[model samples]
Target chain A: MSYSPPRDRLWFLRRRAYLVFVLRELTSLFVAWSAVYLILLLDAFADGALPAFWDWAGTPWVLALNVVALAAVTFHAVTFLNLAPKATVIRLDGWRVPDFMIVGGNFSAWLAVSALILWVLW
Target chain B: MSPLRRRAEPYLWLLFGGGGVVSALTLPALVLILGVLVPAGVLSRPDLTALLSNAVVRLALVGLVMLALFHAAHRIRFTAEELLGVARWDRFIALTCYGLALTGTVVTASILF
Candidate 1:
């Protein structure tokens, strides 16, 4: 006979951290959503339908969806960046770099890139 | 693992990690700018079109879309398996997830290029 461990479908609800972890995983949906949205934007531009696209995007429901996606994607960004230190370890002169430096660097790069994009649009 | 599966695993993971990094660094600002600001009339359409017309900007947008989709696919595949108690069907789940990502990539390329 084969034996398998039992699984808890409600495990995520059992702990706050677990819930956060699940939420972080769920952010992938919004990441995909953002990608699709961008493609739609590009399609609209290509079709010379920018005005229609803006109007559709500005609709209450669309705006609401995007607002929620913004929150979810932002959460994804923060959580992923915070966890970067664990995945990427750097050393100089055989001295391991501290976690804060890695985290700070990730955040700094994030801000710099975002600012550059915004500046270009501005 | 089969030889093909083993070889593809690292590359898939690399795409997942690379996508996470790219999406983390860019998605929020892109969402804020394109979704809210521009649609709400805070940012003008002409400005956006001008920016998008740049070859470098279009290329970056395509790259962002491709990577972000792959990242989402990788996470969603594992998450669905664990959350839904369907790890036994991982191969199917992975195929579906990655297939969607590939479709998105193709659609994005067609639209942009």
Candidate 2:
């Protein structure tokens, strides 16, 4: 098929959608890093070097970065969860899972796991 | 299938597998490890850096980042095309993602080195 002209395709791509898409993508970057950063911290803690860990974690800049990373992580999780059903295929008993169910499941799972971690840590 | 649909199929697969499966399985652990446990002192911190420096840890980090980056890129591109009315800018977004991935790889290599 021949390519449609931009004018003809304008209905498909609105300015607001473009902005949200860009924001979502940008947030995903932070989400990726946040995961890595967390892993690194966990590994550090597991290695049993408290002084060094505190030194790194206690830094003001690092704290700020962590806050930003938290925001990014949340954005990534929320947006990705919202898009999960559209992006994935989940078959249970020969039936496709509803999109709302998938998203709700993900959110519930995330909350449960996060709560578990907090409970254990506390 | 139309050429555009054909081209988009592989990306959809990657998004489903990498962003969906891989992300779901690994991300929660990452959050628990860093967000709650570390902050609460249940897990030691120095060990995390030391672990990161290990070859296995580094490889996993790099792999996850690369996959997630591509997934995000593909999703963003499609969103721009479908919602932003910017189908013409697909190439631009792709190029930017490629650049970001390359830069990320190089930075990761430097950190490892």
TM-score of chain B of each: 0.90, 0.68
- DockQ, all models: 0.80, 0.17
lDDT of 1 by residue, A29-94 (tens): 999999999899889889988889989999988888899999999999999999989988899999
Each model's interface RMSD (Å)? 1.1, 5.6
Per-model C-alpha lDDT, please? 0.90, 0.61
Residue A77, candidate 1: Cα error in Å is 0.8
Question: Could you give candidate 1's fraction of true interface contacts?
Answer: 0.80
> Which portions of model 1 miss their true places by more than 4 Å?
A1-5
Reported per model, the fraction of native interface contacts reproduced equals 0.80, 0.10
Score residue A80 of candidate 2 by CA lDDT.
Answer: 73
Candidate 2 error regions (>4 Å): A1-25, A32-57, A89-94, A99-101, A104-122, B1-9, B12-17, B20-46, B49-58, B75-89, B106-113
Alpha-carbon deviation at B14 in model 1, angstroms: 0.8
Kindly report the docking quality category of candidate 2.
incorrect
List, residue by residue over B1-113, the lDDT tens digit for candidate 1.
67987998899999999999999999999899888888888888545667777888788888899999999999999999878889888888989999999998988888877
